[model samples]
Target: MQDPIDAVLIGAGQRGANDYGPYALRYPDRLRFVAVAEPIQERRTRFAHLHKIPLEEQYESWEDLLSTPQKARGALICTQDQMHVGPSVTALQRGYDVLLEKPIATTPEDCVQVIDTAAETGRQLHIGHVLRFTRHFQKLHQVLRSGILGEVINVDHRENVSFWHMVHSYVRGAWANQADSSPMILAKCCHDFDLLLWILDRKCKHLSSIGQLVHFRPENAPSGAPARCLDGCPISDTCPYFAPFVYLDLLPLWRDVADTSTGLVKFAAKTQLRAPGLVRAVSKVVPFLRQMSDYRGWPRSVLALEPTSDAILEALQNGPYGRCVYFCGNDVVDHQVVLMQFEGGMSVSLTMHGHSHLEGRSTRIEGTRASLNAFVGFRGSWIELNEHRSDRSFRYDTTGEVRGAHGGGDVELMTAFVKSLQDGSSQHSLTIARQALQSHLLAFAAEEARLGKRVVDMEEYSERYLS
Candidate 1:
């Protein structure tokens, strides 16, 4: 039997601790975390304890962890957007292959630097473009490749960033500002771009984009609303984006539940039947219920290490997570669209909006022979293929049995990463730095086009930034 790969984790935040970290625990035979570096003491300690790493191997910063060459086979760099490049480059130079959390870097130059450093050090650098590893997308790619659709002509894709998710991760969370992180497109929709590129297997020739922060400004706040949700906002009950509704109520309820159609219906009924007074009473009796419905995972986990009801309440009351979405001073766009002309005559459009009722992705592909319609959501995933000549259609659905986060792409991505390392084959790597660069470049170009209000030629953009 092959031995498991020993890896170090940098920045034990959401992705590190909750997403990728759990892979080690699930399949210790495939991967093991030997060390962790996180500035936050709570996160660092928690990750160390979960992974069973020794005290000597735990470090408060990436610098300290990589100060001397360690014995780990690789490093998982899951730091914040702006902090990705340095640790990634350092890890490569320190003789550790890296699986870096996405956006590679906030800027094109930094992204290229990580790619270049990896090449120079002869180390593997995999970007976390988990969408490509998903079964739904893989099936989509397979159908497209099968030529059942004939010559592809155009494509339309929509990234429906659920309203609550937009307010949580973008408006009030870590990626609220473009200057602090990457643009909303890069931070959130890079996966979309990567998926499109991978499935089509064509380079985008030129593109134009337009978007802006239409809502979530101070002007949109209710007249009597306070700065924070816990501060007695007047519209707390009616406001869909209310902080408590998300952290205290919805996220917890959906923590273990799949957020499927039936799950959402049940959630709606529960919320509607129970009055605010009843909810408060229940929470008082079961304090932890206030923070998370009954589980201790993401959204709430992002708030506190312990994530007890008291800690969650404290975070909501005092931390940024608790702030009013409209008054949070976030500047990223609420909606955006990108139009791209691929190398061939095929054209594609990608629309990303934060006002979606459900968090999912939907796409339509048109071809000479037929067309394909697909949707992948937390509820489930489905695909329909229509043939023009035969006048027939086929549908595939996985309605029940909830897929894990990111449509079960997270675990598949980790499995691929481990397999690549085990076999020591770059050809088997799904999201190598160079291949992932295409999406990042496209995202950067899309942002530039949006800001400059003009079309960007891919050749010129790539030469100017990447060359």
Candidate 2:
């Protein structure tokens, strides 16, 4: 057996510990977690212990880890949206390849900086665009590239961001606000942007978009309802967006651990020390304590917290997750549309809406010789091809192939990265940083067009910012 490649983890949060890190655990002969840096002591300790990392190899922050001599082949930068650039640049400079989580960075300039740094440092930089590795999309790409759907002309894509997910991540969680995290386009739909570019294999020429926070507002709150779901709100049972019902039922074992509070007053008042107001008065007697003592999977280990009904209830009562979705501080659009004109006259229309009952993306591609349609959701993906003047059409069901996380793309991506590191193959093309830049640029421009309410010339945007 070959010796495992040494790797370092910069963030022990969700993506780091649950997503990419587990691959090493599963295939111990291929990769090893030699070091970890996390601000949270429990998270850092748990991750280090799982990987059997030495005490000297553990640190509190990325900066502390970077200050030491480079000890691993690559670093997994799993920090939040805004925290990507600094650590990535430092890692590249320190002779460590980086497997960075998506969005590249929160801002366009920073995204460009990371790409440029990777190129300048002559190091491997793979962005976590896991969708490209999925069998469904890989099949789509193969079909498109095979010339079966000759002369690709236009594309229609829809990202149906399911209702509950919108509330959990965007409306009620850390990504609720744009300024604090990232624009909805960049944070949520950048993957879609990357898919569009990859499928079409064309440079974006022009872009326009429009979207807004039409729902999930205080004005839209159901009448006679309290701020928190457990606060004797009359409509709690009926309201789909109710905090306690959604968190307890949907999240199941997952809880917003950050919302732990011993007194109901803590959940009611903006300040922890303040007394509860009338709307939040019911929480005075209820102690919203965290009860998630297990960290098994996904949101469990991802959030580095346990998932229990009490934890969910506690988070809903005292934390951001508990706040009424309609009354939270979320500004990201619940629905959006982006129009892209690619080189060679091909066009793409992408619709991202958070009000859907179903989750996943659906796409239709129109070409000269044939038209292809696909629906990718929780159940899996299916692609149908209809040729011109064809007596029959064909359908390809990819459910069997979509086996693991993110439709099996996560495992594929991790496997590829581990192999690339082991073989020292810098030429591998799966999600190189420069290619990810184009997708990030398109998403940023789409946001600009959406907010500025005008068409954006990609040439001009690239020259002004990306250059």
lDDT of 2 by residue, 1-467 (tens): 66888889999888898777778898899889999999999889988888999999999999999999999898999999889999999999999988999989988889888888887887888999998888888888888889988798899999988787788788887788988899888887888888887877888999999888898998988887777777787887778777655544443222221122123322333232232233234434543421222224543332227655566556666777777777787888889999989999898899998887667788999998999999876535789999997746989876535355788888898888887887776666434567788888888899889878999999999898765
Best by TM-score: 1
RMSD of each: 3.6, 9.4
Per-residue lDDT tens digits of candidate 1, residues 81-122? 999988999998998878999988988888889988887777
TM-score of the candidate numbered 2?
Answer: 0.88
Which TM-score value belongs to model 1? Answer: 0.92
Q: State each model's CA lDDT, in order.
A: 0.84, 0.78
Q: Count the backbone clashes (under 3 Å) in each candidate.
A: 0, 3
Q: Which stretches in model 1 have alpha-carbon errors above 4 Å?
A: 251-293, 398-403, 427-431
lDDT of 2 at 324: 77
Instruction: Report RMSD for candidate 1.
Output: 3.6
lDDT for predicted candidate 1 compared with the true structure: 0.84
Q: Candidate 2, after superposition: displacement of residue 170 in Å?
A: 0.7
